[model samples]
Target: MRIAAGLIAVVAVAVVSSSVPPEPRRAAAQETAVTAGATVETEPVAHSGDAADDPAIWFDPTDAARSLVIGADKKGALETYDLTGKRIQRIPDVYPNNVDVRGNVVVAADDDTDEGVLRIYLVDPTTRQLTSAATVPTRVTAHGLCLYRSPKTDKLYAFPNSVSGRVEQWELTVRGTVVTAKSVRLFTLGRAVEGCVADDASGALYIGEEKVGIWRYGAEPDAGRSRTMVDGARPEREGHLQADVEGLAIAGDRLYASSQGSSDYTVYGRMDNKYLGRFRVVNSGGVDGCQDTDGIEASSRPLGTAFPAGVFICQDGYNLRGTTVERQNFKLIPLDRVVLPIGTLPIPYP
Candidate 1:
């Protein structure tokens, strides 16, 4: 009685849509207060265009007002939304599948192009917008993308996952404002891999292997293939990941992965990869609950009154906020509201 898989019913690509259904839907009475209300909801995008797949939170070093939520439309664009969920800029025809931001550097997957490369962009502090900076050709068609800025070495890295199971890591070097990438490490999960995130402080890389589960690897180039499956769908295991694990996001010491099979999110300890609890976004503030979420992101940086402690963003598969019909959009949750009330986690940023 697993909950049915989410957006896979609409995704035409077999490699991406193949997923194991989650256990039956849990009752609404079990919903947690951690996801009670969203601070903002973005405008709707296409329903079945493979749009609004992933999001990356970009923090402005100089001004909190300059922060942005960068997301992949998947169809052919990289969209930048203000903290209020308004579209401020759109980079068209890039065919971005996923995006990640660190400092001024922005990395996105252009797997739809014939070249199938990873594109790098830099945020302009003056304009508070993104501009094309460079491109790194990947060995395989990129499906998932994440960026890592090593806390130890301070070197920047880009990781892109291919539908065929290849994961490539590239170290980026900048010279005279031009960014260049050199592939440093390549590995395989031997299964479809999409959602991925890297913890710079811990030097850990977490990737979602669709039907299988979430796996973690070392973030270093020399870090070998020896890995750990943080959670799985197997019944005998204590792990709670159902199937078709779609997105991975790290906030402080907690790792959040979407269990699309059950339409819920499983939370784990980022260090030990231990399952702590689970929660789902429900209808609040006149907005519908998010289901079949493909991509999710969070930042621990305080942003004024709305998100004093930080913010969390999840892709809403079926958004019916203002209109009668449904489309895809994003939901924002305050980090303080989630962690403070739960008493499960120590505030990471504070």
Candidate 2:
């Protein structure tokens, strides 16, 4: 239950004289994608209803226009959108908070189960449909989730909110566009963990615990033990860590995390969990954007008919609530304003 004033729609452009950071190769080892004064192009994408919850962008190296955008709804529906925010598909049978597309498929981790239950769904890019993949019979108040592929073993790992205050990993099975989740390994975080992203460059991971703080979780095979690249550092918040610790993603050299109702994006250094300034996203000027963000994704796909690269999108929950007591809307955030050379195009989603 938070409300804030809005500024009129005024586009601000900053000089990007600094050398554009290195491309997202497999060697940069950068973590969070910084959106610093990222300019916002004046274009706007339209969608139906109030868009809320998590979203993921699928990279289409072959067809950028055919690329995909998927998001979570308040009623267990995963809606698909094109780059222009056009409704392409609506995947069902999911209680998802966050979704990620890693290896040719979409994986969703949602906590709509009673008691302790973990339900993961796999979405087919070809058909724009969802299949109930795996159900781990455990109790985790899952909210924020990140999926990663082990650079060496190529095993899949999921970082979700903990029932016992630690992050766990599982062996995700992908068979002909179907992914099922199974037990692999479980690890301890400083506290209840949520946001997760892997540094493909170093085969390491960056984890964000809402209250416990930001952490760098890394590991080895048999020769020794896992280690924390960044320890004892935490992100500052105004409320409980559980206040919808929803989004987590990485780009060049930083980690980005957000919480609903807080109205600000939290930042940390990839090398260490030191608190960076928080950037607030506002929809001034009667913009039809909603702000209670729940999901976020970064991609350099392209514009026009598909999600573009370096484009940052998030979900604004609580939209259209109590409106007919029937349905709600999904909100999108374009990160071009806080960061530059990024995607300026509006999230035209359905």
Residue 12 local lDDT, model 1: 22
Worst 10 residues of 1 by lDDT: 7-16
267-290: candidate 2 lDDT, tens digit per residue: 555445455545545444333333
In model 2, the worst 10-residue window by lDDT is 20-29
Could you tell me the TM-score of candidate 1? 0.87
lDDT (0 to 1) per candidate: 0.75, 0.50
In terms of lDDT, model 1 sits at: 0.75
Error of 1 at 285 (Å): 1.7
Model 2 residue runs over 4 Å out of place are 1-51, 114-123, 133-141, 177-180, 219-245, 259-262, 268-277, 284-286, 301-309, 318-336, 340-350
What's the lDDT for candidate 2?
0.50
* CA lDDT, candidate 2, residue 8: 30
Query: What is the lDDT for 340 in model 1?
Result: 30
